[model samples]
Target: MPNTPPSPRRRGTARTDALLQVTLELAAEVGYAGLSIEAIARRAEVGKHTIYRRWPSKAALLMDALHRVWTTDLDHRDTGDVHHDLREQFVRSAAALSEPPIGPVYRAVIAEAQSDPALRAALDERFLHTVEQRTLDRIALGQRTGELRADMDLTFATEILCGGLYYRHLLTTRPVDETAIDNLLDMFMRAYATDPPPPDRG
Candidate 1:
């Protein structure tokens, strides 16, 4: 049988993947400050217009690249234990933000966002809002299941839960170690749980 040529959609996806991969590799090497569409095009052996046709700016391209490398599940698991599920997910997210590639690339985007309003909006819209919504969803589930207090304000709860980790990761030199996470969760449970959490099973 004759081999069928890939469709235009497949070809476009392949090209987009290549562009994103090149963006990641270059960003990893020179940092985002040194990365540019021209450099990425040169590295990918494509015209600058090829990149512009897809992404409007460096931040936009880098955001897509960051998502490509950020494989961590932002959503929570329904383990019937809200505390355990949140802890597991937080630990995974903290590790990802503290490690290389994702960590460094994300920091760069954040730094750039400080001075660029458009980039700041994009970052919040594309990344921050997604995380916050997912967290709130999990908390809402806990409330419905009687794990959390039904009267609690979920938006505030979500902020408190996620803000602690991001604060430590981004603004301070303190480590987001398990001890800190446990302490944060402990406090959150005390303030938000319907009752004290039961002792862990062996």
Candidate 2:
């Protein structure tokens, strides 16, 4: 007989999700430097006060958007092979980041983080930290199983692998394809793989 209204919590969640979606779209369309809370309000069909209730500043809002867009689960199956696993994971990651919606959004976030300390901290805590942990965990697992070299600095090695992806993605116009991924795996794996136990303990 009468229409039902959503609870305050549901309404708030919906509004926040709408704002995040609009924020990402606008970030891709106009870049983060060009984005404004007012523009987000207009695009999200919400009022400025509504946005303020959720996020105090543009950087805060963009950090949330970065977390929403990035920080995803990996689909690479562990075949007990580190090279194949990292290759599949990285190729999938590159392909995803090279696409339209996410590609531009990722570039914008990274660019904005350069000058924004809060944003950079957010990226480290939410995005980079998680990725680094996953990569390092995978490498450690391989080392424990003799699939990778235990002598190498896992943290630095991890950075080289993932950092190369970011460097090529943002700084260079190199095509990120299977061939590129293979080459990356080749270079890193050579240095990363464990050699036979030196014939005898020294």
Candidate 3:
């Protein structure tokens, strides 16, 4: 007698999801250097072949997981006020970086990239480039819209705005907090000072 059931491919997909979730969870618990595909397979409760079938290499699998939560899109938004928009972006960006699971993952990835050529290349080309481009674009936009001083060097501005948060986070081991956001906004606005004069229609 024939039995009613889903196909083998559907079952495989279900197993893949379980493996990915378990992989991310394990990555959070243990640093990337300590991760094991075998352990992931066991924790996921799927066959080892299942994990291998989806992601042939550990780095590829890990990168895939990272991409899902940390988006690469960071287009600058012109909110009519550069300082206000930048402040808002800092708060949101800092919060994202501070997510419990994500924070540790970033630490581990950065360390690994320093030693691993493949991972370093991937990080620079795929992730870091996107972040830097977004930062540069925001500063340039501020100047173009007359919100920043025409003489301000945007390359230095982007570094000054975001680099401070990174260093402070490293020192304090605290997520970039509201005070950091406020300080960045205040410092940049004061430095840039391009308040548009009230216009008259005669």
Write model 1 residue lDDT over 32-131, tens digit each, in one string: 7888899999989999998898788888888877765553445588888899999998888888887776787788878877888998887776667677
Better of 1 and 3 by TM-score: 1
Best by TM-score: 1
Candidate 3 TM-score, true structure as reference: 0.65
Worst 10 residues of 1 by lDDT: 66-75
lDDT of 1 at 78: 84
lDDT of candidate 3 over 140-190, digit per residue (tens): 876776667889988778878867787777667665789878977788787
lDDT of the candidates, in the order given: 0.83, 0.78, 0.71
**Model 3: CA > 4 A from native:** 1-26, 35-68, 72-76, 114-121, 173-175, 195-202
Q: What is the lDDT of candidate 3?
A: 0.71
Models sorted by lDDT, best on top: 1, 2, 3
Best by lDDT: 1
- How do the predictions measure up, each by TM-score? 0.81, 0.75, 0.65
lDDT measured at residue 197 in model 1 versus the true structure, 0 to 100: 50
